[model samples]
Target: MEHSKLSLARRLKLQQLAIFEKVVETGSILAASRALHMTQPAVSKSVHELEAQFGESLFTRGKRGVKLTEFGVLLQRHAQSLLADLRFLADDVNAWSNGVSGQVVVGVLISASARLLPRAVVRMHETAPNVIVTVRVGSNDVLFPELARGVVDVVVGLLPDNQAEGTSGNLTHVPLYDETLCAVVARDHPLAGDPSIDPHQLENMAWIVPTQESAAWRSADAFFEAAGLVAPKRLVESVSILTNLELLLESSMVALMPHAVAEQFVRSGLLSILPLRLASSFGKVGYTLYAERTPTAATQRLLQTLHEVGESVRLELIANSPSTETR
Candidate 1:
């Protein structure tokens, strides 16, 4: 078979592929060497070897740094795609060795549905029935490290922007959807009836805010900062939207929530969205997965499931315009 011919060319192709990717990423030979922990000479030699193989220079020396030649730019793009495919292949192979038929661990945010995950698991079972699917729920702060350590295969949550700071080269993110933040209050709350409320008016109201560690809370803080007001003094901190909703239901406290989760209660007339003009820069809300490499076959399939579920729910809410629904 053609696949059986995994020769020297193939092996060198993979090596050069990695080197070229790192060089393009770091933007210079010295920087690439530091990242790859190779000497500058070795890095240069590797690049030269690759150019020799292709019978063309992949990069040109420049004053600011090394710039990719046209061929190098083209190769960089294709190499990244090829490397991703190779990583996927490797993950598939690992899945087979690690008991192709067993429980798969999934990490999720507290608000995600069991139904959402089960649909994906069911699809996997149709093809690989022996694989048991298990789930763990936590905030991204708790899950990111676990995912990095291989304790969880994939995580579904809004990854903090700062979470990327020290990840080195071990993490990748695929945004599932953007969730807009909105204020959640009881249907009869003073601000609920208004077409739109100003942020400053909330300064005196009791607030049910997530702790500083949460992405939602951070966004809420940014919102207040943008309004030139501090977060309300009498605040109740909760980690999950479910808890925040409970707090809003039993008290006059208002909470910040993603529009999708807030929609559920708002439609039931249990909660009403405040007509406040929030900062358009409240930052994006989306599902992020932390994987050491590209996701495994099962993990990739699970991610696809998550994307499908999230998109379906988002589209439903958009079409219904839950924000416009009356109690």
Candidate 2:
């Protein structure tokens, strides 16, 4: 059995795997051939060789395109990881021979993107100026799967609350600090300067709330219930920070925002934190990575920077936002 494994490994080639991956991505052998700049017959031949070695059909053919069978779906997952690692390997080697220069792709949610990540990037430039930092902004639903698939080096935001829905228990979350969620509105809103807030007053106002699947939504729901308020009916359900900001500025919609995010806009005089505080609802902000993957040096440097910036942000939030004492 060991000999068979070795023989099969010898027969399989990286080019063949690359072709197979492109086919999976494009969903059509002809599209893969065009993308790879190879002849249609050549691309088909490589895929056939891969299928022969595996002894199972990877894709089922149809006139429009091809669809992955169960085996194909499994292989595609591993194939993507392998290719991403190879790219990182090349970058690592190049950086080693030269000065520090490589790419680190980070997935950031709204909480971290507003302050933590930008601060870290600036700090990283002070040390590893040549390191290329790319940021992909999205929610956990989009970022977590990318982290598992090795498409993102790290994710910086609120850590999941023991819920491993899409990741299948392969992620490692490193807690950096905790920040409270605050009720926010445009600086000129009627509730902006109120010294005392009433929970019932907010129920009639149009509000911006997170989608039900998010951790923030769960916390918000609980906070509202504890305050003896019914869920607002005049609602816009969204998790987009930019969209929420625009809606808040243009209309009188209130949003539950992380303290770190709210503080930045508050200083700029664009938004105000309502006196109504969610003292118990705090998000544990951190970075997450795939447990099995070894981060390249560039990624490790960025992680260290995140830790430094995270500490500073944590301290700043405590000194500035008084409501955190309750959390």
Candidate 3:
């Protein structure tokens, strides 16, 4: 007689699944048992039972402890995700039962917080008042690690060109808007007065650029590389949005900034935008969300709000652009 597929009830128990995951992570059953407050024999029995049910050896006992077999590795991968979801579900249900919503921690780059994040937060408050939203601002290097450790529920910024590298598990990305880089200069600067400035004219000018490690800097580097020109010698490396804007106003240096950010300064007449035509395909900026694993319902709702707010902001910017003419 052929063997039947394992039923939900017959499959590995939560304790067994947890033990397998801990063993795989810690590289030893004894360590896993210690962490879970179970005896070594019990941990060993759980692994043995799972292997018997699957009709294959799940671990290879070795001098270095126990390592997973191919089948064991596969099971561990799926089991880890399952366990995470179950934990999140439990926490969410408990919060709901207590008449308090769970919290969603979000990571955002500084540039995004100005318009994108605030609008999203407002929408979230209006829609899910009980769910608390926490926002943390930093570069991707800082935020991605936090995301991986489950410190933050999601990250919103330009999607790294290579999303798969340096990540352990799958991440979800949703494109919200595309951003373009523009030159920001003080209103009194010569370039600011020009109706349109050529890109080559910026070759010898001093530039206030972001640190080389920042996403903005990377985007700027790619743009320069595509143009067959090196970025102008940096007069200052600034990560703070306010400091960069202030530098443009206090000095003759031109700063590369997103069109939306420049627009804010332009409106106040503190800075002016130079209409320099860059390569049509230079750099496309957009927002992305990264999670160590799948996101929760509350996190999903917040993401939806972000996309909606981004669309609204993009439309408003386009409508107010000088390029647009009244009928």
Candidate 4:
């Protein structure tokens, strides 16, 4: 007689499910037993229980360790997510009872990080000192993958111009504002004092290019091509914002930067914005989040803080902007 299709979601206990996840993670029941502080027999019993409930073997044990069965891999993914939700649920309930405090990891792109990110971090620290915030700086190519993999809690940066404005699938991108790009150079650079230079004039100059993975490079290339100028053949690919600024400060090399970030340097006598038209503009700077998963209390609070800061930055960009129109 054939048995009914396996449905671990319907009949499995969370405790046993949790134990199975640990076993798969640790690679063997014996190792998992040590991690969980249970005996080897107890760990074995939990795995056996899972297999019996699902009507399949969850693991094929070898002398060295164990490997997940097809069903085991499928179960592990769902179990890990469910267990994570349960953890967030526990943290949420406890936070309501206790004071606000938890950990949040944010992946931030460099341009916005300098202006808005610190404001959000400062607010978080002042309100909830117990909440730990880790910010990893990267481009969309690097950070968006982390968000999809459940490695990053949230991603804050400029979204690609190609992406439609809205949530799609498991990802949600929110537009904060459009940050304009400007070509800048050191205060002493020859073009620094030029009132206006056409795009063709900059064709042969060395450029501080962003990494190929970054979307900024695409904009830079497009802007030059749009103006009938060949994109710079001589370039320095750098990822760090600091390095870009320093290079621009010490050399004749030109770099494209967010107007918000470039504004201060221009005021400080460190850099000068070349009055050149960029046919292509920097896209909207914003944040992306995992829509399916629930955000923790700390995450929610941080997002609220970011929203406040984002608004201020948007206003500042508008007020200080020389151009009245957006691309």
Highest-lDDT candidate:
2
Q: Which stretches of candidate 3 lie over 4 Å from their true place?
A: 1-91, 94-100, 162-169, 225-229, 279-292, 314-327
Model 1 CA deviation exceeding 4 Å by range: 1-102, 110-131, 162-168, 279-282, 285-294, 313-327
Question: Residue by residue across 1-327, what tens digits does model 2's lDDT show?
Answer: 243757967888889989999998899999999999999999999999988888889999999899999999988888888888887897789678875789899999877878999999999889889898888887888998988888789998888773332444788888788877778899999888887788788888898887787757776786677668788888888878889999999998898888898888998899988776546455688889898888888998899999999999989987766453322
* Tens-digit per-residue lDDT, 1-327, candidate 1: 132245535646687788888999889999999999999998999899988766778989997779999988777766766675665566577667863554456777633533345555666676666655678777777777666655577766555663432343566665554555667798877667887567777788888766777666677777677667786888887766567767787888878766666667767778987766543233433445554455666676666667777677657655545355442
C-alpha lDDT (0 to 100) for residue 230 of candidate 2: 88
Q: Can you rank all candidates by lDDT, best first?
A: 2, 4, 3, 1
TM-score quality measure for candidate 2: 0.81
Clashes of each: 2, 0, 0, 0
Q: After superposition, how far is residue 120 of candidate 1 from its true place, in Å?
A: 6.0
CA lDDT of each candidate?
0.67, 0.84, 0.71, 0.79
- Residue 189, model 3: Cα distance from true site in angstroms: 3.2
Deviation from native of the Cα of residue 24 in model 1, angstroms:
45
* Evaluation by TM-score, superior candidate among 3 and 4: 4
Provide the TM-score for each candidate, comma-separated: 0.57, 0.81, 0.62, 0.70
Worst 10 residues of 1 by lDDT: 278-287
